[model samples]
Target: MLVKSLNVLILIVLLPFFVKAQTCGITNIALGKPVTVSAEQQYHVGADAVDGNVSSGWFAPGDNNYIYVDLGQSYNICKIKIIWQTDGRGKDYKAQVSTDATNWTDIFSRTNNNASTDSFTVNGTGRYVRILIATRVNNWASIEMSELEIYNSLAGNTRPSVSMTLPANNASFFSGANIKLTALANDPNGSISKVEFYQGLEKLGEVLQAPYTFTWANVQAGTYSLRAKAYDNQNADSLSLPVTIIVNPSTRWSLLGNQGTNPDSVFLGTTDNKRLVFKTNNAERMTILSDGFVGIGTSTKPNAETKFAVNGAVYAKKLKITQTGWADYVFNDDYRLPALSEVEKYIKSHKHLPGVPTTAEVEKNGTDVGEIQALLLKKIEELTLYIIEQNKKIEEQQRKISELENKEVNRN
Candidate 1:
């Protein structure tokens, strides 16, 4: 709260100057300490055309590019062109947009050899705007920047609109049942940044993006209005009319976060091919349910430690080898592909990996008295190299046959 207030104070103090930086129809964002607006400098592909003035860290000049700008506001942006110091070695420019600032979606970009002027238009939200140099030339042209022109229609139509999708508008959720909520939001001149969940005037929690879900052991038995409101990155919002949910008292299960660390943690935990289950405790991370499913990300041991889940992935932090000896690190259980050592060792000694030795060992250690269990097992892997070789031979034979048929037809 203190930091937020300080940032607001700084923005207000410097607002007039920043806003006046652009000559006409330009809004200079006063991003204070609390809000970050830059990324690391990247220098690999195109660097000749990139403007390195703003940030020398994240935006390194690649082979065919110069620099990018993030408007810091989402509008029904139509047309925008960059005026830059003329570099004679003329290249192509790309116009791109984004919502989260990380993953950029290119709307329109063009390659050009003209050193005089270039322009483009796109629709998106977020703070980043970039001009990528598509082709690098030996020499460069530096053009002086004069102005960024915007089409007039989009600037005045900022309004928040939202749509709800889930639980059928009017539905009842039993106590301890999973409740998923979804909403699509639009700002006529901006983009929705976050969604706030509310029960009456009390804020329950917040979701950063759309298609949100909130689940837990429903405790209070009554009809409650589930309200969802969306906010732009600037905290501009549109609130929805409350949806009704009947909270039953009979439901036994509830919801839990990974290790119950942060409040904004996603609730669903994956176990094997099924969803993970857990019961709530007073302080400790929502307790692991007894038998229903499994814990967060512990593929080898869930009865033991807490796992961290980023986005929707659960990671096993500590690896326990023996009763006490353990290794402290992170492991993604979903991608727990066996190592070559583990596969080779298990194939030779145990029936863990699929190999010829596994079948042979099973025959030797058969417990059934009447018949041998190993009729012989073929592994999918053994046929991989042979399949490739066979395909190549088949293609060669087909080519040879085509040539022979052509020769015979010519002779006739």
Candidate 2:
């Protein structure tokens, strides 16, 4: 009998209130509306915008209060959405969270304004939460809020970390054997990331870059390739393609020139280079690499060490520089202006320049005599023929000298 009576009494109270107030355990926290507020309880932050206590006449004429909650433990927080309780529709709340309450980190904070979010992630672990009323969007009034929640997040997998881009790529080794590898691979699923080189088949010494390269001196002469694979915290690998490279066991880039008059910058121009800028190497070689004479420096001075490509192979020689940057001023002086003298002889023979009057010298001097234009055309032809003939004759003479010497030795 008593059980039946209690049941009936409980039903009467709950039923009438539901029909009257349309709320559960309803509390009159503000105005006629019912609010459920308890930091201990969990609820999804819903549509209630900064609905802090600002509108309830509870906030002093110019008062602001901050509210926040702590998740208690560190979590990989990717996203968070907040619901406000301010009567002006939550238009005056600034929200923030942190591992330490004293130090505040912004999740989303606005003063009398609305906030939006698609997604974002915090790097590490943290705790603490809060919302403060910075200003009144509707009125400079009170701010009050109720209800809070802590989101449970799915953690991200750590990417296989590279301790180093691994050696200066320019670093060389004599052999490819026992290449060291080192890396830090950890996963939520426990050990997913891996370190690899020469595709995936050749298992490296270790799994990472730390020990990736030990003593390249042991590697034999030839070319090789390298690469690394990163696994998500999930242990899935990204073992990549072979990044090609050359293993030059034999040293090639010699200390061509350095210091003193030879500022290493001289041997630089190539199709790969554009300008002549000075650069210094570890060997104290001040070097310049460029493409053409378009660079801002003087023309190249050739010598035995002055290597140049001829038909794709390097050619070096010791030769007398017939014409040089200072050729106009110096070529005719003490130096054997063999080339220039030849040119002068030809000009005298042709006796005229192209496109000029027949009596150009007289014409240029006083009246029309010869065309200088025609004379100049004659000048180039003479100069070219002279240089070609001279070089050929010299080469032929050298060969004959060598042959004669050999014959003399045989006779003796």
Candidate 3:
């Protein structure tokens, strides 16, 4: 919170001077770079002095000490800014430049410096610079500074580079879908201020972090060209190469991958020899053949003799079968009924009624209920006729016997 408030204050104080700052052509040569300090402490690393943030600092516990910064290469620096901690501002310090560590040339010195920030004008050309501390505001051994900035008024900055990374080149998507725009950016001599995303000439949004991304939602169907613009701290900007994408209108059905010379009919089952099988639980549960024969619980091809086949039993509330004739014809006078003796001989040989399937045949291929019912009804009608004939024969024999008895009595 404190650092944020300080940053806000710094911006407010510095914004008015931004117009003048640009003409100075000044850039921080020490920000976020390597440095060396005489004192060794975890919280007092020399890198903190050039870290660019005012909330953190380098601390040396002893007076008469110094911190060194390596610019990586030589630069003609003209000015330097020293930002100090409010708790322990350095009372006296001196800035120096050197080509080697052993020798140094002093540029500026100060005493009783009570301000939180101090600036100095210096003319120097070296790869290494140092700040030697003489005393603290309280005359204690402690020396602390939040940041150090070196500037060159004659140097010119370069534009940063930006590039889009997502929604790849020449990609396609569905209409009204959310599209994500992403980019990466870098500045060679300064920090990236912001990256702005664009569609054609119109701006979409901006992001400041790496893996920088933005979501564009519910875009209408059309072809679009996208790009990103990145700005550096120096206000110089650069634009990325554009990426093109096409969005098609929404539809109920779509095909994935390439569809070329598609099948005449797409089926949800396998086909072999013009027989298709539907499956459930990884097992074949139904089948249909090219000739329109259907089967359940099996995939075997049905022949002309048997149009429909089922491997499992079926259950229904009621069933009806249409036939050309029925057992009612058995009562017709012209209908030939087999003799009872003949039926008895056939049953003994076949182990079943003359016209019915044997037990072995029923076990192998199952029974036809309609055929069985018809056969049994015919047999019952034939049995009724046989009983009538037997009754007539017995009656005739009894009547003849009675006559014979009467005649004998008469003779007596």
Candidate 4:
């Protein structure tokens, strides 16, 4: 009996040191580590809970007071241990968890609690945990505790990080063409599943393949905030920094020329707001006026008779004319064939061909190749008819002369 009493006394002396606060299947990952703790008000300071000093801890100000903690990263939490002050026991308390700090879910809650040190079994997994005290003992207006400890196993997951590469920040472009957007993403511990692109809050598109890219075509003129979101195989996601871009309504363009020479460029016309003006070395090369008249080498509006006006020569291998009437009518039987004498008279008076332009006219206004070819064909057909008539007259005269000679021979 004396030996058994000695063993019992030793057990009673060492019981506090051997107390197993929780029976979680995992290890205590939150012990003596740096954590972010906050409260409505601190008795001394809330950081003392994770400071590993059991003698010092946090004291919240009022009923419904709460103590929140962030484990720095996500973890698979299994249990929590709360060490209260000798005089600070709570009647009601609850525990909660969250992946993000804002949203939370209750893992455990208790009522009518009276204990200096309390242990709660929690089946929670998150990066943040909080304790809410609904009521405290002695009808105290505030809730008090000496320490807050969380027992957890690391979740072993990492979210992917992403960034936009194309349409660089503050870049500008025209409204009509396609804009190619590109993004680069990285996942340290896993493979990337997809990348989603967005403009402001609206999701534009998604890409699943490598070299993640998307083309936004014919985007209207406006300011846009472009971003990309990357998702990993573990369903963890992260967003990239936004890129601001501007799309102009009207397009300013240029056509490059050889080195040391001026390029042909286009811009909105100063005189007419709707017109597009083309320039070479800052001189007017061509103008597409507001009236839809296109002029080359001049900005003067084209006259009523001209649809297209050019101030230079044009060389073409072939000229196709789609006229409604053609020179084939000159070959008709009923067509009038003018006398050669009449053509001569007209040429002498006009100082030119019967229907062709004079030298002075040709020098002043360029010739139409198609029109000249058709007129020459008409004259050739007329000449052929005149030759046939003359041949007929010659044949008649030869027959008459032959008859006369034969008659003379008979008389002899």
Clash count for each candidate, listed in order shown? 47, 75, 0, 0
Candidate 1: stretches off by over 4 Å: 1-154, 216-219, 251-412
Give the per-residue lDDT of model 2 (tens digit) for 1-412.
Answer: 9999999999997885555321111111212222222221123221122234322222222335444445555554444444334443346555565676678776664553553221222333356545555554465343433333334344333344433254434455533334443333334433543454442355444343334443332455555665555555344465544445445443322365322222243343444644444534633222333533221222342333433322223346853334223213322335333466664676687874333345654544433113333345455555566677789999999999999999999999
Which lDDT tens digits does candidate 1 get at residues 135-237?
A: 5444433322322333211233344776556555568755445577666677765667787777678777777765554443333556777777887644557
Can you give the TM-score per candidate against the true fold? 0.27, 0.22, 0.40, 0.38
What RMSD does each model have against the real structure? 31.5, 26.8, 15.9, 23.0
Query: Which candidate, 1 or 3, would have the higher lDDT against the true structure?
Result: 3
Q: What local lDDT score does residue 91 receive in model 4, on the 0 to 100 scale?
A: 82
The deviation in Å at residue 22 for candidate 3 is: 10
Candidate 3 vs candidate 4: which has greater TM-score? 3
Identify the runs in model 3 with alpha carbons over 4 angstroms from their true place: 1-58, 61-64, 106-112, 119-122, 149-155, 158-196, 200-225, 231-235, 240-248, 252-412
Task: Select the stronger candidate by TM-score from 1 and 3.
Answer: 3
Best by lDDT: 3
Estimate candidate 1's alpha-carbon lDDT, on a 0 to 1 scale: 0.49
Task: Give the winner by TM-score.
Answer: 3
lDDT of each: 0.49, 0.43, 0.81, 0.77
Worst 10 residues of 3 by lDDT: 257-266
Write the residue-wise lDDT of candidate 3 on 1-412 in tens digits: 9999999999998887663333344568888878888785687677888888788788888677788888888766688899988867888888888887668888788988989989888887778888888778876556788999987555356689989999899998876678999998999978898999999999999987776899998787789999999998877899999999998665423355322222434334345557776788998887787776788876675456677887877788998987555688989989998887888898888778777787788877767677778888888888898889899999999999999999999999
